[model samples]
Target chain A: MAIKVHGIALSTCTGRVLLCLLEKGLEYEIVPLDLANSAHKKQPYLSLNPFGQIPAFEDGDVQIFESRAITKYLSRKYKDTGIDLLGSSSLTETTIVDTWMEVESHQYNVPMQKIIRQMIVNPAYGIASDEKIIEEELEKLGKVLDVYEERLSKCKYLAGDFYSLADLHHVPYLVYFMRTLKSSVITSRPHVNAWWKDISSRPASVKLAESMRI
Target chain B: MAIKVHGIALSTCTGRVLLCLLEKGLEYEIVPLDLANSAHKKQPYLSLNPFGQIPAFEDGDVQIFESRAITKYLSRKYKDTGIDLLGSSSLTETTIVDTWMEVESHQYNVPMQKIIRQMIVNPAYGIASDEKIIEEELEKLGKVLDVYEERLSKCKYLAGDFYSLADLHHVPYLVYFMRTLKSSVITSRPHVNAWWKDISSRPASVKLAESMRI
Candidate 1:
């Protein structure tokens, strides 16, 4: 049986797992959930992912959730097949990759989400954007980006010269983040701009991203 | 030169790395910071951890931040020496461990922190507890715990019969959450209560938690 991912393609977490599948050159199906009716948050889906989240994964007898976990699992399981994203069998390199991955989730993703919600989602729902929130989160994100700019100046990628899961992990949310008007948050930092361009423009990333609706 | 952890022992993130060091039987010194004056958020320390977080780690030429990443690096680097907090020598087992570790961070940690802040931190600071936030977070935590209860009933630990980092990741935060009045949020579920008792009573966890100064 082919691998299966049970979530919509357009969702960020789902897209993360899907992109990993594409990079690994694996065949899989997106078992679409009826989000309009909260189907993903309901019984059968909850049984698959008790947290009631998107992108529950299954491969024959194996099951996993959490987009990062699924991506990590796919990378490890198909280590021989895919482009290596876990740092080429070096613990030191993998540690660096793991460290930046944490930074992406904890530091970078937080302010990115807050800014996007304020600058994009709120406007779509006819809710006024909270200027204070946008300002504070943007400041927070800038500090993280400053760190990224410095790091990327030192290395070709967040983990080092090699592209790893750490870089791919940023793609899903960043695709949304870059769409917002404040994308200059990225463009203003030269090394960061180059790194983003490099990763987002990857054949696998670009191919998967094209299917992701704006 | 012993490993040095740069942060106060009592801090959550700091305690996280310290507990991992103890579990790994690694010698480490705590280089205390004056967090009351925001010393961690300032220069020199920011050089160690650009995000200005606690529990930055140093070992000879190696430096790492983020408690989970630090813990992971320690586990991998010392794979032969310590009680393996990662699952032992099995890719499938490691993936399951990784999955639950993500769950602890994303689903479990969020509600646990919110409940702790509203119930414990708020009250201690002369800020009245927000009952509404507490109620909602507790409900969220209860659902996650229900999943834990079901999972734990089937296996001795989250990643399976053997202990893993996924179980350990809950220690520092749950220590705080357990101190809150809403600790019944954990104790109310039988298997979860047993699981907590088992992990929390481990000598390394108990010894480090004692100096936590709650």
Candidate 2:
């Protein structure tokens, strides 16, 4: 059976896994759930992901949730078939990739998601945007981008010269940041701007962006 | 030369990497930065971790920051020594471990750290504790623990029957959670309490906990 993904295409985390699958040239089925009706919190879906989160994945008898974990699993399982996402040729290279991936999880994602929630998601739900919170998040994000600016000046990608999962992981949030919020936080830094343009222009990323319709 | 870690011994993140080193029985030296003196945010250290986070690690020519990333590098580099932290012998097992690790990062860490800051860290720095924030964080943490309780009731550890990085990652934060805050969230759930007891009682965890002097 082909691999299956249970998630909405518009979801950021779901888009992350889909982009990885696209990059790996893998065919999979997306089993969409009616998240509007809380389908994810119901019985059958909870069986797939006990946390009731979007983007549960399945391949043969193996099942997984957490989009980054799914992407890592796919990268390892199909290491020979596609681009080397892990970049694990050496211990140092692998450590570089892993380090940036954690930075994304712990640092970048927090402020970015907060910005998205405040500036985009809240407005969509008829809730007023908290300008103060957005300003704080923007400041935090700007500091994070300053570090990225410095890193990209030294290397072509977050991990290194190669485009690994670390770069791919930023695409979804950047798309939302650019299209929905139209933030200058990314474009203000020369190296970060160049890196963003480079990664977001990838054919696989373009495909996911088109699918997201944000 | 032994591996050198550039971080304070008392930091949760630094302790995280130290615990991993202990678990693997690796010899390492702590380069101990004075965070109270703003040493991490200044030059030299910023070059090692541009984000200026604690727990930058060095071995031979390779330098890495981010505690989880450091632990992962060690696990893969020393896979044959001590325990199999990744347990990636099979696809299913690896995915399980990775999924829970993401849970720790995305779900568990957020509120746990928030509560720690509000209830413990603030008072140590002579800042007033935010009771409202602590209550809100505790509610969020309680819900997360409910899921953990459900999972631990089914398996011996977060990932599976064997201990993995997923379980190991929780030790430092839980130590703070128990020692500094003395929160009843974990102890209130029987299975979660049992899981904590089982993992925290490991020889490596015990050694690190003692070193932390919580």
Candidate 3:
């Protein structure tokens, strides 16, 4: 049976899994959840993900949720066919990859999520955007990007010279980030600007970007 | 050089690395940090982890931070001697393990962190505990545990029959959590209680718990 993902392209995390599928050159279908209607937060979908999050996956009998986890599964399951995003064969390289990936989720994604809620979600849902939150998060994000700039100056990718999941993981939110608060956060740093350009331009990311409406 | 962790036993995250090292039966040393003085957030250590988090790790040439990332590295690097916490040999099993670990971090750990701050961190610093925040987080945490209760009912551990890193990662925060909140959250659900008992009593967990002085 073909691989399947229950997610919408517009969702950055859903987009996260989709980008991995595209990068792996794998065929899959998206069973998009109706997030606006709170359908994803209700039953059936909740069975797929108790947390009522999107981008659940299925391959025959195996089912899993969590976008990052789904991508990890795909990277491992299709290790040979795909680009070897995890670098599973190299312990040291995988160590660095895991570190940067953690950095993305823990440090980068945290502030980005708050900023996205204010800049994108609030506006779309008719909730007032909190300028205070945007300011606070953007400051934190700028500091995070500073570290990224320094890291990227030393290495082509977050993990190292070779592009890995760490770099790809940064693409989705960034696509949304660059669209709303364009240029300044990214373009300010030469290395970060080049790094963002490099990864965002990847065929998989470009394809994913086209589908991200909001 | 022997495995050296720049952290303290009282720190749940530092304890996280220690649990893994003990599980692997590897000899290691804890290079304590003066978190009280904000030393971790300063120079020297900042060079170790730009994020300025506790529990930076070093094993000869390899130096990394982010406690979970460090644990992941240790699991893979010492896969043979230690218990195979990753389930790397089986793709499907690894998928489940990855799924639950993500659930642990994104879902369980998020609320737990907030609750811990309101209850434990605030008290220690002579700050009043935010009952409002504690109540809100505990409600969220209760729901998360409901999911855990259901999952544990069907399987011995979060990832299935195996006691993988998924369970191990919960130990640190939980050690602090149970100390403050205690019993009610964990013991309310029989499966969760039993599962907690089983994992926490494991020799490594017991040893790790002993060091979790807070």
RMSD of each: 2.0, 1.3, 1.5
Better of 2 and 3 by DockQ: 2
| CAPRI rating of model 1 | medium
**How do these models rank on DockQ, best leading?**
2, 3, 1
TM-score of the candidate numbered 3? 0.97
- Residue-level lDDT of model 2, residues A1-214, one tens digit each, is 8999999888899999999999999999999999889999998999888889999999988888999999999999999977999887987788889889999999999999999898777887899999999999999989999999989999999999999988888888888788755467888899999998899999999999999774
Against the true structure, what is each candidate's TM-score?
0.94, 0.97, 0.97
Residue A71 error, candidate 3, Å: 0.7
Question: Residue by residue across B3-25, what tens digits does model 2's lDDT show?
Answer: 99998766789988999999999
lDDT of 1 by residue, B1-214 (tens): 7899999876777888888888888898899988879998999999899888888999888999998999999898898877888885887899899999999887888788788778666776789888898889888888889889999999999999988899988898888888767788789888899999999999999988798765
Candidate 1 has which clashing residue pairs, if any? Answer: none
- Overall local distance difference test of candidate 1: 0.88
Model 3 / residue B214 / CA error / Å: 3.3
Stretches of candidate 3 above 4 Å error?
none
Candidate 1 stretches greater than 4 Å from native: A118-132, B122-129
Task: Put down candidate 3 lDDT per residue, A44-140, tens digits, no spaces.
Answer: 8888898888878898788899999998988988888768898676788999999998898889998999998889878988999989889999999
Best candidate per TM-score, number? 2
- Positional deviation of B190 in candidate 2, in angstroms? 1.6
Q: Between prediction 1 and prediction 3, which has the larger DockQ?
A: 3
Q: Summarize candidate 3's per-residue lDDT along B121-158 as a digit string, tens digits.
A: 78888999888888998999999999899889899999
